[model samples]
Target: MLRIKRLDIFIVKSFLLLFIGTFFICLFIFMMQFLWRYVDELVGKGLEMSVMAQFFFYSALTLVPVSLPLAVLLASLITFGNFGERYELLAMKAAGISLLKIMRPLIILVCFICVVSFYFQNVIGPIAQGKLGTLLISMKQKSPELDIPEGVFYSEIPDYNLKVGKKDRKTGMLYDVLIYNFKDGAENAHIIYADSGKMEMTADKQHLYLHLYSGELFENLKSQNVKSQNVPYRRESFREKHTIIEFDSDFNMADASIMSNQATTKSMGTLKASIDSMTHYGDSIGRQYFKEAMGGAYSQPSGLSKNDTLRIAEANIASYNVDSLFEAATLMQKQKIISSAVSRTGSLQGDYSFKTYTLETNDYQIRRHRIEWHKKITISLSCLLFFFIGAPLGGIIRKGGLGMPVIVSVLVFIIYYVIDNSGYKMARDGKWIIWMGVWLSSSILAPLGFFLTYKSNNDSVVLNADAYISWFKRIVGIRSVRHLARKEVIIHDPDYSRISDELNALTARCRAYVNTHPLRKIPNYFKLWMSVGEDNEMKAINEQLESLVEEMSNSKSVTMLTALNNYPIIAVTAHVRPFHIYWLNLLAGVIVPVGLFFYFRIWAFRIRLSKDMERIIKNNAEIQDIIKTNNNL
Candidate 1:
């Protein structure tokens, strides 16, 4: 049995509070996005409140899998950020608790969340998606509420266009209405002009009732005698007329079975069954097509085997010339033969085209089912991957609240979204393998999570801007001038004799190294990269130079300290090779572009090194001269 620690409880409670809040916030955001995509279908359908409630509820359920990973990322980031900002993490570490130890409870929590995500994706998500899809189709099929504006034609009614010149708002009456009816075809249209009319829906809301006070109606009549020159029609005037138009305003839910075959409406088990069935179906169709191609047009003639046909063709090979035979034939016979060949070719082409289309459709469905099957597992794993990344990153940055965490989370999530979406499209289009495309985002982010966790656990300065800046400076050979100020209080005075001897030895070493190495000449390319060793002579010279500067700094003289500041800070191993490992150096050398870049970079460093050595020699001579002058005084 495992005992629960107070520390674990505290960590878990803090994470849960934040997780609940972030989860809902993320859910609402995704739901709003879903609503925006189908807003047009829902806007004018006049759906009931209960229907809308179901719409959003089902939408939330369908969006849960997408929202969970982002929620985990943000919550973990804020939780760890708060810990680091308040120095709570520092205290825990001081008390001998490791970062990984403190994160143990949350890791377990995230794993549970992953399990829940998978369950929702495989079980709950499909049902909700089916319901949502059915609801959307019903909404789109439902007629818009009847509202005819003044001076505009309303075409919302089927087969009719009505324009109202004016209306009475209180009485719900129309004035100067013009209506066109094309129910009997446009050629036999009916045109009506009504002085006043009122429109209302029937009790069942399945038909529209139109009552006109005074109107003139013109109806076109189709002529029975085709040869007659005169067209016939009818005109009638009515003081009161009632017309019924077929308009169904009542909301009727569509058949949910219509969406049952959709890939989004299937669970993992169903998806596997569907994929197997479709694959078998596709394979059978492929084999049928192959058999037809082999036997239909390309087969030997009736009662003749392939070998018999080949033997007969070989015997007649020299006796028949198709071009000469065509020239010997009558023109009409040649035309008949050409027409027959063209007809046969067209029939065969159409048949094969139909078969190809059928196979492609079946194969596409199989890919969809396979893609959905892999999606259930990949999306769940992303939740765990995101937590490791967020927790360590938050600890490294040491920021809390919404400001920094929100920005970082958004950027990271955007990267994940882009990679995941691109891979999804690629896989769906069959441009990439199903597993590789679906797993692309997880593969890319797994290493990042590991790297951040390792860096944060070791308390490394991975996120420090100064560290990167220093590295960039070193890479570009940008050296800094040393600054040494005179001390007002000194514990020990410098011995001019000892400093003088050291400076002479350092200057002699620098001159000898610079002279022998010939830094201005180009180095051997192979030796520069493949050979790996530090320049011990330059290393010893730099050490001695620094020591001499330290001893001379205690002098009371201001000029002596000023001369000490001019000594250049030498990069010990820069001029030798790009990396310490021989393989890495060889890799850089093998790739021409990369090798060329490093080669020129090393050459520039060599030039800088030569200048640095000259400066060291000059600074040494100046200090030695100052020491001699002081000794005489």
Candidate 2:
């Protein structure tokens, strides 16, 4: 229950943040739209005030769906991002809470939101869109406030055009109004002339009242002329009282597109019927292709050719793939196209229409439309998918400052967007199955997010300990191997230079091998005990090394002599591959031998000096045979 409450709080907070932020942003966009549409008419064309107000209101409603999903995504990200940044996620982890346990409530909230979003898509969204469309149409038809000068006439309204002059604002009156109302046929159309008139809009702005002091209405309804007889004509004059012209009903509920809810998609049943019809047509196309393959006398063709019966079957397949063409067209329609107004009409050629017509007969359009419909449903469901991905990712990247997290989120989203759009295009072109195309990105990303989250939950220190140590050494001027104390007393006059030369020779051999193979290069200095050469290399090298250590001991390097006497079983094993370069192994081999040898040499010298100092203190006998070996340079 406590867990449930926490999740509830999270979701509510996320939704509110998203809703408020998106609403203001979308509202501003809608206001700009309203201004752009009627601004020219309002300023230049002198359009009225009421139309502008209605336009904005309708525009805002139509833009809700587009902004809603974005708001939801942003809000959810911020909420979880804040939690992760604050180290609350770490605290939760320390308390032994599983990631899934933490995210459970959030997922439940998203599910509820999914239902709400679906409702908006199916119900409220359509109504708002319909109203917006109707409002735009009305704005196009309605005239703004007439801004005629004192004594000039203007004629711009088409079909039954009017020219009025000398307007009086106080009485809403005008003089010399010439109205031209056309009859059925332009050959015998009659016009009306009014000497003076007063115009007033009704309360609802539907009807117009014309109070003409003197006016004549003429009608020239053409009749069959019997051998040069005059055509029938009628004329009527009106004076004094105003003539009320009732405009068409302004607010017919039935006239609103929303009243015919299924106009956008005829019916839910129609979509189902369309799916069924397409399936049947696909089956029929398959049958036709089969029948076409079995040509007369059933003789197999020697080679593939368009004229061959099998080739005809293939052409039939291509023709049946007219569905792909229709699907492409449907996608193109859904994608907003930019074209000049002058080029819009009659742009679709006769051949194009005929091809479309034939395809429609075979249920091509319905299949294409079904693809679109499914794509939309999938896109909407993607919101839920992204939420899953984002929430999990946030928990994982726990270093959630705005900068890193936001950058990562945006990059992920960009990749997702590109993939999803590519899939959508492929599906539209019939290059991919509808479900596969629509769901591909989400399917790929969701698993990736899960893997990342799981990896993040595991305890692994990402920083390198060796690297940190190296940095410390560089900073403090510490050497890799520190110097130790020396030893006393000389035992053997060993050729120390010869042993050193042999060590160098062995190192050079390793280097040469490394140069040739390039990948298997490691020193084996400690392997003096392992060599079984015909020259007894191991025994000779060990004896030479022992003698060099004895010389160093006599020179009072105590550590080296103590090491040689205490631990004589020195062994080395080296292996190298041509393709694999294990650099750390190479480093270890170089460092360990060199480091230990120096330390032992120093200790042996220190021990020798201590023994000489003790002999001097005892005053029993002078220290003798402390001879240093010289190399033949």
Candidate 3:
């Protein structure tokens, strides 16, 4: 007997419940989409309920493979996100449970799901596909029961167009009816016009009886003589006319074997066999084409003697240049030769076109079969891939419910869907190899799964905005310092009145300098735009602030010392400011985009510096006030 842990049971219970709901929800959505594709065939045809039921059943089975992976992805994401959101994950971690250990039960369940999905894909998917395909064919071939509308030409019947200007809804009476009967042939059609008419079905529903009042009939006599080039027409006017039109309105089922050879209808074994056979056939065709393309060199002429053949083979093609020959020929000879050449070219072109069409069709068919083979396995494996992706992503985000998880899942799946669809199309169109295109999404997303898993396990703050901003500042050579004292330090209160006055003066001077700064003008901006140079103005302010902070840290009051310590060391950089290279303006004008971007960066930096100086001045004033109060005490 095997023992199961309570933790495993608890986690499995949560995941299973969510999985069941999500799977059914996904199935229902996909089935609705599937039904929409054939709604035209299913509706308005009076199809038997049994046939409709059969279609829906098969459609559900066919859609399972597509829906399963997405369901797993959503369920796993939501489950983990819930754990993280409720701090269940934190409690588990506190209990010495690693994320992987906590996820073990759910992981096993997901792996089991993947295996079941593969079984369905390999065993059941093909049969369901076959049944659905047969249903589609039957629906297409089954002639729809007639329901002719007014003001539209009805061409449902073979080779005939029936039109009625107005239809009486209650009495089934048609007014101003015209029928173009092209059953004999379009060129030899029989035209009939009536002021009023009534249509009725025969008891067996095999034929339609059209009873018209006050009608004229016109018949083309060309059908009587097959050799007749000219159409002889006969018209007759009658008070009453009756016509019997043959139309089969029965919902007949088509043969299932008609769709057996398609990619969707084949089992894995059958698909492999077909691919092998097709590959061999393609190779044979290629060899034959190559032989033909090798021309007369490899295929000897039948009438030539050995010596004559040798001479012909050795002869230069330029010696018989057609252009020169035609130019030198008499007018009559040239006309005859040109006519013969044109006729021959037409025949060859037609032959090549037919051959090209055949080869292209075969090539695409082989690609489809191979793609299907890859699809069966890849789609099954996607269940596992998606789980890893969504679980780790949810863990990292620590957001639950439909709000964040749903948005993130949708975005990730959309990216995969777009890449997958594009690659499949490229492969199908012969722009890429079948396997490479089929696995393109997997290739990109598999690595992403690994990365997310690693980050989640290590608790990396990969998505933190402040971390990224700090990194960006560091990369761009901007300097900063954090203030955290290793131990408590007491500050001795000193010259509070003088310090306050000096702080006030510093703020005033900094403000004044900012407003009167030479680099604040447009001409200075243009100069900076063309070159990168150091600004002594902001540096002077930063140095002055730094010196004042150093002086303030020497106070004996602990509160004042701590308050001063809380303020960070500040530095300003004008990354895109003016430089001393006069000739660089010419280069800046040459590359307008780079010049403008650097110019903007510098301008923004200057503004930030101006703000930073004012903030520093204000912060210093507060420190001075704190020191002054402590000194008075």
- In terms of TM-score, the best-performing candidate is 1
Using lDDT as the yardstick, the better of models 1 and 3 is: 1
Looking at candidate 1, what is the lDDT of residue 41?
Answer: 66
Instruction: State model 1's lDDT.
Output: 0.90
What tens-digit string does per-residue lDDT give for candidate 3 at 413-440?
A: 7898999999999999999999999999
- Could you tell me every candidate's TM-score relative to the true structure? 0.81, 0.48, 0.72
Q: For candidate 2, write residues 255-345 as lDDT tens digits.
A: 5643333323332344567667677876676576456435522446657564675666555554577556656775555354334333443
On lDDT, the candidate that comes out on top is 1
lDDT, candidate 1, 117-233, per-residue tens: 999999999999999999989988999988888999999999999999999999999999999999998989999999999999999999999999899999998899999888899
lDDT of each: 0.90, 0.54, 0.79
Flag clash pairs in model 1.
none
Model 3: worst 10 consecutive residues (lDDT sum): 570-579
Output candidate 1 Cα RMSD: 5.0
Count of clashes, each model: 0, 34, 7
Could you give the candidate ranking by TM-score, starting with the highest? 1, 3, 2
